[model samples]
Target: MPPRNAARLYPLVLLLLAFVAFPLYWMASTSLKPQTEVFRVPPTFVPETWTLRHYVELFWLTDFGLLFVNSLKVCLVSTGLALVVGSLGAYALARFRVRGKEAYGRLVLLAYMFPGALLVIPLLLLFRQLGLTNSHLGLSLAYLTFAVPFVMWVMRDFFASVPVDLEEAALIDGASRLGALWDVVLPQAVPGLIATGIFAFLFAWNEYLFALILISDESLRTLPPGMMRFVSTTDTNWGLIMAASTLATLPMALAFGLIQRYLVTGLGAGGVKG
Candidate 1:
């Protein structure tokens, strides 16, 4: 609290920021470097010859544009689905007094206990039987197997933190239960929702296993798996890889930036029971 202590902390904070920011700075700098500069024995800290050739190539030469679209679509849809379904499930767990409620709650989380590698084969067979393989909707559903459980787990606490009297008041005002949730409760839980949505989005955006296994169609491959096309047995394009990685981070950055204030509040509230 003292001025001297605050001054000591500022340097530590800036040092921490620089440590965190270095990778981003390197990725961006490397992506902008020309091929000649990227592999130079003594690598330049900044690009000697700054260029957008990698990005230009990314859009014009490869299937990157489509991959970007596929990732965006799948992550968005999956996040929305997770939020809706998980919120309802969490609400039920929070509000309902039913037999096996604790068991069911644990079961929801048990889905996440196994590694995706263990489940991919059975999932493949199921997808084949249902003709869900290689479809965005199918992948969206696949993502929910993970995201929904997490959402339910986190949101249970958040929903529990919401006052039941608020919902009772809404009921007296002639609002349906869902109406009360939407009109009264969700507003108070915005921070949690936003935080949960971010986690769901990151899961879908960065997930590779299901995207690779469930989607055989080249056009349908999400970014993580799709970007591997840039690698070959003989060669790897560092610039191309860095460029893709840099671009891949944008949607998440924008999402966080837009909801920066909500993130800390939501994560704190949603993570802890009142």
Candidate 2:
């Protein structure tokens, strides 16, 4: 509150701002700069002349639109499946006296922690056998393995925070267990569910390694892998790459901004014990 304290905090605040905003500002600035201007002797922070060429080329010459749609589909479907299944599993874990509940939760978290790279080979082989290679559904299914456990852990904490007395009262009023969960418990857990959904969506949307290995067709590629195609061995189109990166990042930015409140709440709830 003192002037000296405020002044001391200003440097940290400025550093944080620079760290977060600099990359985004650079991406936008690079996207607008022409190829010659981009690699000019003295690097220019701002574009001397703005052009829509990169955006135009991206849409017209490349499969960027299809990649964007593909990424969106994977993120949405994967997140939806994760949240629905995770929420129910979390509810049961939190509310019911299932045997080895603690062990099960730990096992789920352990499974989630396994690196995607480790599973890629086996997953690819399995997909090949199932004829699911190059398919969005296959990618979505792969995403679920990581998404579900984190969602379950977060939602279980949220559900546990809501007292069982409310559900008991509903049961006394003749509401079924599922009805009570739908009507009473779920409303209280919206923030957690939204937070989990955002995590799942972002994970599925930005995934690159699995998409790279599983998909061979240009049409089936997601944004991250599709963006890589812009960078070839001989030359890299910096402007177009930046533009594509900007486009890919926008949805995640918008999604986080929308559900940030819930995300913060859910994260905090997960840290505390019921």
- What would the TM-score be for candidate 1 when compared with the true structure? 0.95
Clashes of each: 0, 0
Give the TM-score of each candidate.
0.95, 0.94
For model 1, residues 1-274, the per-residue Cα lDDT tens digits are 9999999999999999999989999998999999889999888997889999999999999989999999999999999999999999999998889899878887888988899999888888998899988899999999998999999988988999999999999999999989998999899999999999999999999999999989988978899999999999999899989999999997788889999899899889977772
lDDT of the candidates, in the order given: 0.92, 0.89
- Candidate whose TM-score is highest: 1
lDDT of 2 by residue, 17-107 (tens): 9999999999988999888898997888889988878999999999999999999888888899999899999999999998999889878
The lowest-lDDT stretch of 10 consecutive residues in candidate 1 is 265-274
- Model 2's TM-score against the true structure: 0.94
Q: What is the alpha-carbon lDDT for the whole of candidate 1?
A: 0.92
